[model samples]
Target: MGVFYRAPEPGAKPFVAEGDLITRGQQVAIIEAMKLMIPVEADASGRVLEILVADGTPVEHGQPLLTVATGDADRAGPGR
Candidate 1:
């Protein structure tokens, strides 16, 4: 199974999705809500497999922002 990223708000403007693997510090996407620009982050170290949102599209909270295939997904604890 892969990890999925979800939007944090409902009917919010979508940001640009950078389908690039982010080891620790990387900008994945942005969420524009109430004229505020919020950056979405990648939570794990892996390759970015899919981006589920289009630029300027309205996104909902808990929506799948992207999917990542982390090699440590089967681990019992956080990735080291």
Candidate 2:
């Protein structure tokens, strides 16, 4: 597990948010583990439906950090 950050640094824009369009390999969050900061990215392009983890919170392995609606449609359900 590691501390999660929406924005890696202070004063930086959030990586992702609700209703935001995201692309493949887009950095969505940051995980700080063992004093190292790692980025979490999206596997597919889609619109961000929801954020599952709060900023600065600890996240476990295989945790669902957020939900995305894939494809050109605006479907933000459980499909993704």
Best by TM-score: 2
lDDT of 2 by residue, 1-80 (tens): 89889996987899777999887778888899999998887877788898988889998987888888888553333312
Which of the numbered candidates is closest to the native, going by highest lDDT? 2
lDDT of each: 0.54, 0.80
lDDT of 2: 0.80
Task: Give me the runs in candidate 2 sitting further than 4 Å from their true place.
Answer: 72-80
Candidate 2's TM-score: 0.84
Question: Which pairs clash (backbone N, Cα, C closer than 3 Å) in model 2?
Answer: none
Query: After best superposition, candidate 2 residue 38: deviation in angstroms?
Result: 0.5
Model 1: colliding residue pairs: 9-61
